[model samples]
Target chain A: MQGIILSNETNALTLAELPKPTLKPGQCLVKLSAAALNRRDYWISVGKYPGIQPEVVLGSDGCGVVVDGPDTWKGKTVLINPNVNWGASEQHQSSDYSVLGMPTQGTLAEYIAVDEDRLMQKPVHLSDEEGAALPLAGLTAFRATFVKAKVTAGKKVLVTGVGGGVSQMAAVMAIAAGAEVYVTSSSEDKLNKARKLGATAGFNYQGAEWVKEAKSVGGFDAIVDSAGGNALNDYLKLIKPGGKIVHYGSTTGKPQELDLFRLFWSQASIIGSTMGSDREFEQMVAFVEEHQIRPAIDGVYALSSGVEAIERMADSSQFGKTVIRMEA
Target chain B: MQGIILSNETNALTLAELPKPTLKPGQCLVKLSAAALNRRDYWISVGKYPGIQPEVVLGSDGCGVVVDGPDTWKGKTVLINPNVNWGASEQHQSSDYSVLGMPTQGTLAEYIAVDEDRLMQKPVHLSDEEGAALPLAGLTAFRATFVKAKVTAGKKVLVTGVGGGVSQMAAVMAIAAGAEVYVTSSSEDKLNKARKLGATAGFNYQGAEWVKEAKSVGGFDAIVDSAGGNALNDYLKLIKPGGKIVHYGSTTGKPQELDLFRLFWSQASIIGSTMGSDREFEQMVAFVEEHQIRPAIDGVYALSSGVEAIERMADSSQFGKTVIRMEA
Candidate 1:
C-alpha cells in the first residue's frame, strides 16, 4: 500500500510504500478510491499544528469501497467520516476522537483502517472524487452554518473567503436551506463562481469596504467567517442586532480587539463550530440528496499528486473541492 | 408613574415622577411588582458599556401584572422576556415585543409598555423577586448551554465564575439536564453555594490550574465561560476534541495568545451566545416551571436604592440574583 507521509517539521511530503492496515474488530479496511485536501492538512504537514504524529498518513476526507468489515458493512461503497475516537475511549470522551491526518493515520493511501461506525454509504450518484470531498469540508460547512448559526429561510448570511472548500459548501448548502447566501472572495473569478452557484450576491473582498458591499445586499443575520482575522471585526459590525458571527477557522489568528462590549450590547454572538456530528452529517446528506445540490469539482489528481492538491489549498486559488483519485 | 433613572454617569438613581406609559394597540402596559438587576444594568448605570440613553429606565428583567391590553391579555400575571428588537423603525413591527432594557426601554420603571406577545405567564409558584430574576441570566444560560453547546446527559461541563447570575443558572440547569457540573469561583464560599445547586465538583479557581481541576471531573464536554481572560486560554486546553466552549462575557478583557491551533486540530469549538429568542424564552420558562428551579435571590433593595444594587454587582461579593422591590 502507498500513502503520503509527513515525516518531519517544515518539509515537503514523501510518498512511501506502507504496510496495509489491519482492521480491528469494529474497524473497516477500506480500499480508497479518492481523498480530499484541506487547510488543516497543510498546517499539519508543516508541524505548525502539533496534533499530527510523524509517519501518519495525512488525509481525513476519502471515499472507498469497504474491502472487509462487519458483515453488515462489507462490500459497501462509503466515505470515511474521519473523526475516529480510538478505542480507550467511549462515546464522546472528548480526548478520544482524533481527526484524520492529525493524531491518527488518515486516508491518502491504498488501504486504510477505520471504525466501521465512521463509514457512511456514499451516494451512488456522486463520483468517488465528490464522495471524498463531501465529508470533512461538507460536514464543517453544515455544522458552521445550520447547526451552529441555526440559519434559516430568508436570513441574510455572508460566507467569507468563498474560494475555500468549506465556505463554498456552506454557501451552496445555506442557499438550499432557503437562506439568501452572499459570498466574498479576494478574487473576482472566485466571486463569479460563487455567484453562479446560487449565491444571491458576490463581492471581491479585496475592496476596502467589502463588508459594506455585503451589507448593501441586506443586513446579515449571521456571518460564516471562514476568514477569521481582520474581516472578523468588520464581520461583527455587519450582522443585525442579536445576530451571530459563527466561526470554524481562525485563518487569520486569535483576533485582537474582541470588543466584548459590542458583543454584549448588540446581543450579537461569536459562535465557533467544527465538523458536523454523525447526526448532522446524515441531515446534510439528506438535504443534498433531496435538493440535488452538486458539489463543485475543481480538478482531480492521482493519489500520487496529493502535494498538488495541498498546494491548491495553500494558494487558495481553487474554487471548490480538490480531490486525489485513488482508482478509477 | 415612577421609574429609577440614571440622571448621569455614577449619579445616584432617583425615583422620579413620570407620565405612565400609554399602551399602543396590541400593547400591554405592565404594572410593576418587582424588577431584577443584572451586570448589564450596572454597566449601563456607569455608562461604561454605552448604549444607555440618559434618564432611560434601567431594568432588563422583571415580572409584573398587565394592567392594560386586549381582553385576552389584560389582568394576566406575566414575566417580561428581555431581548427585544425596536419595532418603531421596522414597521409591521410587533407591538407585543418587549426587551425590558437594551435598545428598547426597560422594566425598572413603575410601568413599561410592551407588545402583548412578549409576555409569558408567570410561573404559578414563583415570587415576583424570583420571577424578575429569571429572564436575562436564565435565558442566556439556557441558550448557551442547551442550544449552543448542546450539552446533554452524562456530559462533563464547566461553569466558570459561578457567583454571577448566568453561571448559577448554568450549573443548576446543567445539573437538571443530567450533566456533570463543575463550578469555578475564586471564592470558596461561592464554590459551596454551587455545590448546593448540584455541581458534582467545585474548585476555588483563585490560583488553581482549572484545566487540571476540570480534568479530575472527567474533562469538560462543554465549558460555559463568563469569566474570560487568561483563564480562557487554559479552558481552551481542557475541552475534549469536539467539545464546545460557549463564551458569553469576559469580565477579563480579551486575553492575547488564544491558541487557535489547538482549536482547529482537535476539532473543538468556542460558541458565543447571548440572550434567547421568544421561542427559547418560552422553553426556558417551561423548564423552570417543570423543574421548580428556584432562582437564588442574593438581596432585595428598595426602588430608591437602585444605585446600591449596581454598587453590589460591582463589589462582586454578592451571590445570586439582586432584586428591586416596588411598593406592594
Candidate 2:
C-alpha cells in the first residue's frame, strides 16, 4: 500500500510504501477512492498540531468502499466521520476523543481500518472527490454555523478568511440556508469566487476599515471566523447585539487587546469549535445531500503527488478542497 | 426631595436637594425606602460607563412604596426592575434598552418616576435593603448562572471575584439550586464569607497556581466571572469539556495571550452577559422568594452618607452589597 506519512526525523509529509492497516473487531477496512486535505493536515505536516505521532497516515476526510470486516458495511460505499470516540454528549466531545488523523492511522492511503460507527453511507448525489471533501470540513462548518452560531434563514452571516476549506464550506452552507451571506478574504480572486457562490458581498480583510464597511451594510447576526488575530476586535464592532462569533481555527495567532466591554454590554458570544461529533457528521452529510451541495475542488492529485496536494494548503491561493485520488 | 446626583462639573456623587419627580402616563412615582450600590454605579461615577448624562440620579437597585400613580394602587411596596425599554427579544436587549441609571434618571432618590412595567411586588420575606440589592445584581447573576452557564444540581460551579454584588448573588443562587459551588477572590475574608454562603470550596486568585488547585478538586462544569483578565486562560484550563464561562464585567482589563487551542479543543464556550431582561429579573425575584434567599448586606448608610457607599465599591473590601437606606 502507498500512503502519506509524517516522520519525526523528516517533519514533512512524504509518500511511501507501507503495509495496509489491519482491521480490529467492529472495524471496517476501507479501500479509499479519494481523500482530501484540510488545514489540519497542513498543521501536522508543519509539526504544529498536538499529539503528532511519528509516521502516522495523515488525512481526516475520505470516501471509499468498505473492503473487509463488519458484514453489514463490507461492500458499501462510505464516507468516514473522522471524529473518533466522540463520546455521548452532543454538547461536546469526550476527553478521550481524537480526530482520525494523528495518533490513530488515517485515510490518504490505500486503506484505513476505522470503527464501524465512523462509517456513513456516502451522499449519493456526490462524486468520490466531493464525498471525501464533505466529511471533515463539512462537519466543522455545520457545527460552527448551525449548532454554534445558529445561522438560519434571514440571518445576516459573515464568513471570514473564505479561501480555506472549512470557511468556504461554511459560506456555501450559510448561503444555502437562506442567509444573506457576506465574506472576507485576503485575495480579491477568492472574494470574487465567494460572491459567485451566492455571497451577497465580499470584503478584503487587508483593506482599511473593512469592519466599518461590513457594519455599514447592517451588522451581522452571526460571523464565522477562522483567523484569530486582532480581527476579533473588529468582529466585536461589526456584530449586532446578541450576535455570535463562532471560531473553528486560529491560523493567524492570538487576538490581542480583546475589548470585553463591547462583548458583555452587547451580550455577544465567542464560541470555540473544532471537528464536530459523529452525530453532526451524519447531519452534515444529510444537509449536503438535501441541498445538493457539491464541494468545490481546487485540484486532485494521484497518491504519488500527495505531497504537492498538501502543499497547496500552504499557499493561500487555493479556493477550496485539495484532494488526493488513491486510484488515479 | 433628595437624591445622589452625578454632574459633569463636579464629576462626583453629591447628595443634593432634588425636585420631586412628576409621574407621566403609565408611570409610577415611587417613594424609595432603600437603594443599593452596584459596580455599575461606581463605573458611571468614574466616567467609565457609556452614555453618561450629567445631573442624572446614579443608582439602579431600589425598593420603595408607590406613593403616586394609577388607580391600580398608590401605596403598594415594590421592587424596581431597572432594565428599561428592554425591547422584544429574550435573547438580548433591544438597541434602545438602558439600565435604570445614566441617560435615564435612576433610583438613588427619595422619589423616582419609573414606568409601571418596571415595578414588581417586593418579596414578602425581604427587608427593604435586601429587596433593593436584588434587582441589578440578582438579575445579572440569574442570567449568568441559570440562563447562560446553565448551572444545575450535581454540577460543580465556580464564581470568580466573589466579593462583588453579582458574584455573591450568583454564588448564593447556584448553591440554592443544588450546585456544588466554588469561588475565587483576592481576599481570604471574602473567600471565607463565600464558604459561609454554601460554597463547597474557595480559592484566592492572588495565590500561586490557583488554577492548578481548582483543577485538582475536579474541573468545574461552569464558571461565572466578573473579572476578565488573563484569568480567562486559567478558566479554560480549569473547565470541563463542554463547560461554559459566562462573564458579566471586565474590571482587570483585557486577557493577554488567550490560548485559542485549549478553548477549541476543550469545546468550551465563552459567553458575555450583562444585566438580564425583565423576564429574567422576574424569574430571579421568584427564585429568591422560593428559596427565602437573603442578600448579604455589607453596610447600611443614610442618604447623606451615599458618597461613602459608592467609595466602598472602589476598595473591594466589602463582602457583599453596600446599600443606602433612604430613611436611615
Candidate 3:
C-alpha cells in the first residue's frame, strides 16, 4: 500500500510503500478513497506537535470503502471519526482519548483499520474528497458553533480566520442554522469567497481598527475563533453582553491578555472546544446531510503529489480543505 | 430617615438625613434592619463604578421588615434581592437590569421602597446582619458554583481568594453540596478560617510554587475564582481536563496571559458570572435554608458608624461580610 509517511531521520513527509493494516474484532479495514490535510499534519511534519511518534502515518480525516471485517459495513462508504477512545463522559474527552493521526495509524494511506464504531456512512450528497474533508474540521466547527456557542436563527455570529477549514465550516454551519454569519480574514480573496459561501459580511482583520469597524456593525451574539492571541481582546470588545466566544485552535499562540473586567461585567464566556466526541461526530454528519452541505475543496492531489498538497497547506495558501486522492 | 450617602460635593460617604421613601403599586416599603457592604459599594465610593449617579444610595444587600404595602403581612422579615428589572431571559440579564444600589435608592437607608417580587423571607436561622450578608455574595457564589461550574457531590472544587465574600460563600456552598472543597488565600488567617468553614484543605497562594503544591494534592473538577490575573494560569494548571473555571470578579485585575493551548487541549472553560437572576436568587435562598447555612458576618457597625464599616471593607481588613445595623 502507498501512503505518505513522516520520516524520523529527515523529519520530512514522503510517499512511501507501507504494509497493509490488519483488522481486529470490532474493527473494520477501510480502503481509503481520499484523505484531507489539517494544520495538525503540518505541525507533526515540522515536529511541533506533542506525542510525535517516529514514522507515523499522518492525516485525521478520510472517506473510504469498507474492505474487510464487520460484515454489515463491508461494502459501505464511510467517513472516519478521527477521534478514538473518548471515555464515558459526554462533556469532554478522556485522558486516554486521542486523535487518530499521531500515535495511531491515520487515514492518509491506502487503507486504515479503525474501530467499527468510528465509521459513519458517508453523506451520499458529497463526493469522496468532500466526505474526507467533513470529519475533523466539520466536527470541530459543529461543536464550536452549535454545541459551544449555540448559534441559532436570528443570532449574529462571527467566524474568524475565514480562510481556514474550521472557520469556513463554522460559517457554513451557522448560515445553515439561520444565523446571520460574518467572517474575518487577512486576504480579500478569501473574504470574497466566504461572502459567496453565504456570509452576510466579511472584514479584513489586517485593516486598521478592524475591531472598531466590526463593532460599528453590531455586537456579535457568538464569535467562532481559531486564532487565540492579542486579538482575543478585540473579540471581547465585539461580543455582545452575555455572548460567547468559542475557540477551537490557538493558531497565533496563547492570548497575551484577557480583560477580566470586561469579560465578567459583560457576562461574556470563553469556551474551549477541540475535536468532537463520537456522538458529536454523528450529529455533525447528520447536520451536514440535513442541510445537504458540500464541503468546499481547495485542491486535490494524487498520493504521489502528497508533499505538494501538504506544502500548500503549510503555507496557508488554500482557502478550503486540501485533499489527497488515495485511489490515484 | 438616617442613611449613609455618597455626596457629589465631598466625594465621601457621610451620615445624612433623607426623606422617607414612599411605596407605589406592586411595591413595598421596608423598614431596613441591616445592610451589607460589597466591593461595588467601595468602587462607588471612589466614583470608579460605571453609571455613578450624584448622591446615590450605595448598599445592595439588606434584610428588612415590611413596614407598609401589601396586606399579606406587614411584619415579615425578608432579604432584598439586589438585582432588579431582570428581563425575561434565563441565559443573561436584560439591558435594563441593574444592581439595586448606585443609581437606584438602595438599602443603606432606614427605609427602602422595593418591588414586592424582590424580597425573600429571611432565613429563620439568621439574624438581620447575617441575612443581610447572604444576598449579594450568596447569589453570586450560587450562580458561579452551581450554575456555571456545576460543582457536585464528590467533585473536587477549588475556591480561589477565599477571604472575599463571594469566594468564601462559594467555598461554603460547594462544601454544603458534598464537594471536597479546597481554598486558596494570600493570608494564612483567611485560609485557616476557610478551613474552619468546611474546606477540605487550604493553600496559602503567597507561598512559592503554590501551583505545584496545589497540583500535588489533585486536579480540581471545578474552580470558583474571583481573583483573575497571573493566578488564572495557575488555575488552568490545577484544574482537571474539562473542568470549569467560573469567574465572578477580577479583583486582582484582568489576566495578563492565557495559554490557549492548555485551555483548548484540556477542554477547559472560563465562564463569567456576576449577580444572578431573580430565579437564581430564590434558588440560592432555598439552598441556604435547606443546608441551614449561616452566613459568616465579620462585625456589625451602627448606622452612625457606616463610614467606618465602608472604610473597613475598602481596606479589605474584614474576613467576612461587614454589616450596618439600621436600628442603632
Cα lDDT listed for each candidate = 0.79, 0.89, 0.88
Top model number, DockQ: 2
Clash pairs (backbone) in predicted model 3: none
lDDT of 2 by residue, A1-328 (tens): 9889996577677887889888788989999999999888888878788887878888889999998997899899999998888888998888788888878888989999988988899988899999998888999999999999999999999999898889999999999999999999989999999999999999998889787889899999999988888888899999989899998888888887778888888899888898887788888888998999988888889989998877767777888898889995
The deviation in Å at residue B247 for candidate 3 is: 0.7
Q: Which runs in model 2 stand beyond 4 Å of their true positions?
A: none
Q: Write the per-residue lDDT of candidate 2 for residues B1-328, one digit (tens) a residue.
A: 8888886677788888888888889999999999999888888778788888788888999999998888675889999998988888888988888888777888888989988999999999999999998999999999999998999999999999999888999999999999999999999999999998899999998889888899999999999998998888899999998789998999999998777777777878889898888889889999999999999999999988998779767878887898898885
Q: Candidate 3, residues A130-153: lDDT per residue as tens digits?
A: 999999999999999998898999
DockQ for model 2 equals 0.77
Root-mean-square deviation of candidate 1: 5.5
Q: Which CAPRI quality tier does the interface of model 2 achieve?
A: medium
**Rank by TM-score, descending?**
2, 3, 1
TM-score of chain A of each: 0.93, 0.97, 0.98
